[model samples]
Target chain A: MSYDFMSVQQRYIEQIEAALEGAIGSEEETLYGVVQEAMRYSTLGGGKRLRGMLCLELCRLGCGEYERAVPFAAAIEMIHAYSLIHDDLPCMDNDELRRGKPSCHVRFGEANALLAGDALLTRAFEYALRECDYAAMGYERGVRGALTLAQCAGLDGMIGGQAIDLRFENTRQMTPEVLGTLHALKTGALIRAACLMGGIAGGMDEGQLELCEKYAAQIGLAFQIMDDILDVTATSEELGKPVGSDRSSGKTTYVVLYGVEESRKMAQECVQEAKKCLHDLHIEEPFLYDVAEMVISRTH
Target chain B: MSYDFMSVQQRYIEQIEAALEGAIGSEEETLYGVVQEAMRYSTLGGGKRLRGMLCLELCRLGCGEYERAVPFAAAIEMIHAYSLIHDDLPCMDNDELRRGKPSCHVRFGEANALLAGDALLTRAFEYALRECDYAAMGYERGVRGALTLAQCAGLDGMIGGQAIDLRFENTRQMTPEVLGTLHALKTGALIRAACLMGGIAGGMDEGQLELCEKYAAQIGLAFQIMDDILDVTATSEELGKPVGSDRSSGKTTYVVLYGVEESRKMAQECVQEAKKCLHDLHIEEPFLYDVAEMVISRTH
Candidate 1:
């Protein structure tokens, strides 16, 4: 059964926020009180919650109970949040704004921010593996899902992408190939994991999971291109954060290489390919389609 | 077939070092070459592979095949290495020497060191979960072992202990209770996890796992007390690293609270209790018994 796109997305976002509040020890201050505060501030402060929603929606479309995926959903968001925190470190991107507020390192000390990222990454595995405790999704799903999550976060994926991105800054290595490889690991890998994990948790067959991954890759790449486009075209207010950040940082982005209009066209093409994957898989989830659209159309 | 303590220890250490070399992508550098190099440098440059040995030795003693525990043994060492990397960060302990060489953050920059720690931690789970690939270990053990690893590494354990240690620096919060809690999380939990995970991998019953935990805790605490004693009693030449670091850092170490003599006596008492647990549980692992002795008597 298809869902009403906006309502389902909104509902999943709310559930994810509440669950994250509970998962992050928000009710009671942990003994790691300052790090806990830092984690909660970075995580619960506010974002689109797109990763959580993507996971829950895919699990639902895979004919699984969405409640069982909630923990994993929140876990992926924590992983995403940790990456953002580390990316904003003074020695890294050195951005002072995230989601319209001072970044974690800007608010907390750099050390606490670093520890909070590590703590958040550690907690993601804890939460992902806890899926084994729930009856609706048993050990097999939990183990596989958690492993998938770990794989995407490791050197082969997000972290690897980040290293390459850092090494290429203000360098002459800004080819289209390098940029594509960079985003594939930096942003696309985790997004792919979010979808793959949901399908795995839902007990989808191998072919179905592959299809989910294909769709995820397309959308993930589209999402990054759209981000690049918005960096050049959208106002800082419209973006809810600073615009022209990519150019100012001396980093190569899709818009920098292909121009804003071409970058916008490329994003739309990716969204189209992503929709084709859903059609081929015969996925009946309206939320998934709308989610793909949101990536490229967010600025509008 | 009980063997000489030294020989058995030497053999296992060799196997662990070789296995870790394989596990940390020794075949080729990862895409994140610098971080990979930092991880390899910190991990392979060993002081003692104590954690890996505990896991493998206990597994062997549990009547399981030693080979089946190799991956996990390598994984725990990676976890230990990650902790050291983060602990040596300029923002943390600010130590420059590890294993008589420059620490990870000193050798590599702070940002790469932080990412290396994250990558190592991520690889630990990746390796631990690969136990699913072996027909001997099976998914049940692999999944359970990994869950236990995550539990020990998360907020309730190592990270939590680290935060407390950081906060209590140069502060008046040094109670016996606080010191007890700090060390319990800082060092004890992973040691406990090492033994308990060995038990879990060997298919030990729940009661047996609980007994393993008890033995682990006593020894783990005693190990920390001995470390404190060594910081005061040992020399830079003997310790192979700087001594008196704990006091210089304004930490509330066991020796600080109870004096060197009392801390030594307390360490001996804890070691004795640790041996008593093995007697009570009828664990016939002589290496484990010797391991407890080595914790308190390593000044030579």
Candidate 2:
């Protein structure tokens, strides 16, 4: 690799942060203005911009301008942040701390936090429709990219997965198939969409897009497996919030089924498959390669 | 005026219901499948399909096929249903009934209701992107229409108004201007978007679009005013829920500020202005005119 992966990741993160700020702000002071404040608090605070970065890199690798993907990248990040806020709600995960600070509901109150999540999710489409142009990619490509986003975020995707996750919370009878489907819908769907949308923006043909999807699917599962491994091995300080949360919640995870050693091996295998998929795409950019590696190897 | 208004409304309602069903429904049922069931219950049940009818009618008036507007129409209804579901949450209005049936959270639980709302909201865009083609409406028009939905649904629109509504729940110090902004954001924004999207679908010029917006703005406010009037004058049986809810909840409504007489006057004036705007748009169908009149005259 000619360029440093850390530097590249930092650049995308900064771009995503700036874009997110520009997309949401209040010009007038009103009681309603607190909505924007809650939105900003959850979104602007530091976290891994993995979703947005994947989108940007995939768009570039797909032959589209990285700039054209910035709005979309930021939008994806907004969706992620909203999911976190809602996930931490008193009724959901009941989490109080996020990024080592009070969660959105903790600071903004429950109602405002909920609205903030709703606002973020809605604004994602708003930005995609108004700012991100298919003309920069292709008209059809733009439409498809946005559609992919909505689909991945909808019932058959993230929401569906979340429902299953919440339902099977205390049941240790989670079959491997259900666990696989659960993670695929909950997290894999959106991650797959990020890469696929980048491919669409790059004007990738059906074959190429399928390859992108294949790569994203592997990395997405691998990413979750690594997360499970980290929960067992990593310190609370390193993991940002409490470690062993999955265990406490009794949430079925890769580590829960396959011991630590096997989970690590599985994540590495998935990353290897992801790299091979990237290689089949016939582009020699090492950026995505490094990203897939980071997904498996990262401690947090 | 030759066609029966009831029949026209029935036709559109049926279409919206069918489209909504097709847009949602999981082929494979899982333990988590109740999300779709909850979505169907709140959405497919009986109610005025007013928002959707507006989109379809405006599309027809603007010179587009009403069928082309069906998917978008259904999407708007999903947005409305989602707003209602979230609005009735324990943290929000805590209502237990809607359209003579148990509120979604009542039947499905708070967590599932929340996910159902989120799913419906997400699926609205999915349907728009996947099924509603601008080829019948022009690509830019399609994009603009979807964008309108997002903006109306986002922080600057419905979510923004809802946040303020929740914040000022017990505070009776709402000024008229603040009240206006609140209603405009809360309900007027979505109504306005419905009309405008119909116009874009119909290929309306800028002047025609502006006329639609003007007509919508007045009718939107009138619609809310009539809602306030019903709250005070109508019975619980007529409303299919608790009447005088605004008073009991300490919600500072238009009727609270202006009194029954003045609020009635304001609503009538809005209807008259809306009819004028419709007239100025050179629409002779009398459908929109009757709809505007219906807005003020409906008892429940």
Error of 1 at B286 (Å): 1.7
DockQ (Cα-based) for each candidate: 0.67, 0.83
The candidate that achieves the highest TM-score relative to the unseen native structure: 2
In Å, residue B207's CA in model 2 sits off its true spot by 0.6
> TM-score of model 1's chain A, to 2 decimals?
0.95
Each candidate's chain B TM-score?
A: 0.95, 0.97
Candidate 1: deviation at residue A140, Å? Answer: 2.9
Candidate 1 lDDT over residue span B1-300, tens digit each: 657999988999998888878777763554568878888999985757777888887787676567777878888899899999988888778888887788898888887888889899999988787554346766677777887888898778888899888888888568999889888998998998898888877777788888889888998899899888888888897876799888887888888888988888998899889888888778776888999999888982
Report the error of model 1 at residue A214, Å: 1.0
Please report the interface RMSD of model 2 to 1 decimal.
1.0
lDDT of 1 at B133: 37
Off by over 4 Å in 2: A26-28, B26-28
Q: Give candidate 1's whole-model lDDT.
A: 0.84
